[model samples]
Target: MNNKNINRETIIKFNPSQLVNLPVFLLGMILIPGLCLLDDLIKLYLPSGFIPEEIELYIRNLPVYLALLYAIYLGYQILKISCIRYEISPEEFRYYSGILSRKHEFIENYRVKDFSINRPLIYRLFGLGNLTIYTSDKTTPVFKMEAISNPQDIYKTLRGLVEQNRRAKHVFEVD
Candidate 1:
């Protein structure tokens, strides 16, 4: 492998890029609870006979329930997105995922056949894209990196490393 272009010590590691809807999700996380609290405050100001007691109780409690549901959904998203990570080394591409326990997968650069970067309109707006690597590894024929920034550069680096590794290995195919 060419040692000059590749840096053995400088590993590229990063988490998933923030989604375009991230701000909306975060707003819901705060707004839901605040609205629920406000509902309770409004109830204290209204006269006791403004509505039937049973109906009033349900109406006041609905926001809290909605808030609870939204909280769970938001928490799940945070956990899933935070747990996933990508790492690019000189000779291998690694993907790490899982919440409590971790799962590690490594793909040798030499086995990569080709790769492509997809920058859809929305992803481009957010400075994020999807990178797909087609490889000879049977366990994982196609590895994908989603919601990553600067996918074009990453793809180029990975493609260069794959070429270098293949050349070093003297791998050749007739077909």
Candidate 2:
């Protein structure tokens, strides 16, 4: 593409939805209670002296420990999702990710081979979808934009950009 046609301005920028962590959150909710119940069952069925006091104490506090760990994990999941950012310009797609360290990736628009959108039942309720881009870029052959809003519109815009970029770059896919 000629320098005159280059547009560095970002056309679309988005971060994945926090709702993607729903399953992990639900599992933690169920697991903590289940662990407490199991501890109670063990106490009720076993003789008082059958298990050592230290072991008994550990069993009794297992749920609290697990809950703390789960909380940390959930926080990490939220942070990880928040750190991911995607940007699409007319010429290329940019992906930014990392919690402690930042990583930036780019795929030229002309390199995009195909696109697919997946809207799961849960995601559909929230008007969110996952967009997968199949690209010729070797660094990232398949890129997924998970749990983003208004994916259909983005898909259409990207499809047009890809066509335009390919024509400008004189790139033709044989297959």
Candidate 3:
């Protein structure tokens, strides 16, 4: 008999930490073979033997180089995802992120009004979402979380706090 239950804290991500595009990867895979086909086609078409065969060969090989360059570009684009981490405590919710330069933001619990989820078609298809937060403070963000995962849960949690603050009448960020 085996019975196991592990209790873990709720980890919320308002955005995706990594990028994934199966189609782009697949396109690169297909392009690898297509380069050879295109090179052969160019070789067959560059007629008359007037130009040096070496020059023709170089021209024919250009597609392979182009395909390799495009693959590199795709890799760079897909690698642009930045990680977002949020820690929600009784006092404040803190957000932190940086692929290079670290940035941190803290929002007091009481000033929060509500949070809305934005799931455009691209996000929905790709399993990504954003959280837009409403707060009393004039700070930009109006509270925005991007590329986060499990946004619906974060939205619900933030919304629940609005009513909780209402009952407590707590004032946050007095400055």
Best by TM-score: 2
Model 3 worst lDDT run, 10 consecutive residues = 1-10
Give lDDT: candidate 1, residue 40: 71
How many Å off is the CA of 167 in candidate 2? 2.3
Better of 1 and 3 by TM-score: 1
**What lDDT score goes with residue 37 in model 3?**
83
Question: Candidate 3: where are CA atoms >4 Å away?
Answer: 1-41, 46-58, 120-129, 136-139, 162-169, 172-175
Question: Which runs of model 1 end up more than 4 angstroms from their true locations?
Answer: 1-7, 20-60, 173-175
- TM-score, ranked from best to worst: 2, 1, 3
Candidates 1 and 2, the one with greater lDDT: 2
> Which digits, one per residue and each the tens of the lDDT, describe model 3 over residues 1-175?
1112322222333445343454577787898788878887877887757779878667867997788798787866565444456766544667776656777887766778667788877677766787787777566449776656667876676566555655676444444
TM-scores for candidates 1 onward, in order: 0.72, 0.85, 0.55
Model 2 lDDT tens row, 79-151: 9999998888888989999999999999999999999999999999999999999998989999999899989
Candidate 3: clashing pairs of residues: 14-148, 15-147, 15-148, 16-147, 16-148
Best by lDDT: 2
Clashing pairs in 1: none
